[model samples]
Target: MKHLLTLSISIFFITLFPSYSQDQSDNDFKEEVKRIEQLTIKSIKLRQQINPEAEQEALNDEIKTLDATLLKKVTLFLNEYGWKSKKEIGELANMGLFLAIQHSSTEEMESFKDIIERAYEADKIEENSYALYIDRLKVRNDLPQIFGTQYYFDEKSASLRFNEIEDFKNVNKRRKKVGLAKIEKYAKQNNIALD
Candidate 1:
């Protein structure tokens, strides 16, 4: 009788534990997502404050520190859960991934490119974000950007300018297809004046 009772309890726990762990994992994943979102926003705002002047050196240092911490967490999360585990989590992961791109070495960016492509093919991330990643990678390689997602403030020209585009004439068509705003509007919104 005792043996029977023990066996039943064992079976009950065996069945319950997997579900319990899964629920825990889900919660943990969401918490990480929230962290990533907050960190990414903070990093972007800090980056905007950075300039050539030494006045913002402290802010730039903070941005670097945040980027390093964010990259470590993101690398661990990607190693554990990979790129296809959850839709919402994948979207949040993109925020971390973009920040990682800003600070990664060349080889690291290459590896990230593979992960981003895989995520895009799996439909885990949206097209717009996917394009941004690819375009950033292209810019790093000194290749023309396909999606026009990367831009810089040209202080000399007093305009916001996109990275080198593969084809200037059809860039807007490609941008629109990926749900990106028209280039002129994008430039204006980003405080870049068009010539």
Candidate 2:
């Protein structure tokens, strides 16, 4: 019985967290990430109305298609390579990886979280990216986030506001540990009311 139980638990973990293989070269990884970044940037620019309102529907559809493609690529990359350190893939590629994950569906966002944490464990995830990812998840789950990296418009204040924070008083300390700006500065930059 004990052996059976242990086996089941081991299989569960193995299924959820597949082993990583570094079969792809650093240059290849960088190039692929750049490709994903190009798609993401195009989608973002379209959303920002770089073109005309007449093109909005077609462009939004393009963004959706591009997002799906990027998500597939990102899932494959993560399953094979896991999350590489910034030292391994450079800052841009590292950020590119986060961008691909960030734009994924909420389920995908939650699913790839452990994979992304590999970079965080190595202390090499890019600046503020990890914080933002975590905060995004927390807010989505209706929980208080640690870092003030995710915000929404609060109707009460009639302005953008950081989501509720865990240990509000110590949030800056946590942010500092994770390479995020102080809560005050971040709030100010986002035009959120500290009061």
Strongest candidate by TM-score = 1
Give the Å error, residue 51, model 1.
5.2
Per-model TM-score, in order, reads: 0.79, 0.70
Report the Cα lDDT for residue 117, model 2.
84
After superposition on all C-alphas, the RMSD of every candidate to the true structure, in Å, is 3.1, 12.0
Task: State each model's CA lDDT, in order.
Answer: 0.76, 0.75
lDDT of 1 by residue, 145-170 (tens): 99788877667775667788888789
**Poorly placed runs, candidate 2 (over 4 Å):** 1-31, 43-63, 155-157
Off by over 4 Å in 1: 48-55, 84-87, 90-94, 153-160, 193-195
What lDDT score is found at residue 43 in candidate 2?
Answer: 56
What does the lDDT come to for candidate 2? Answer: 0.75
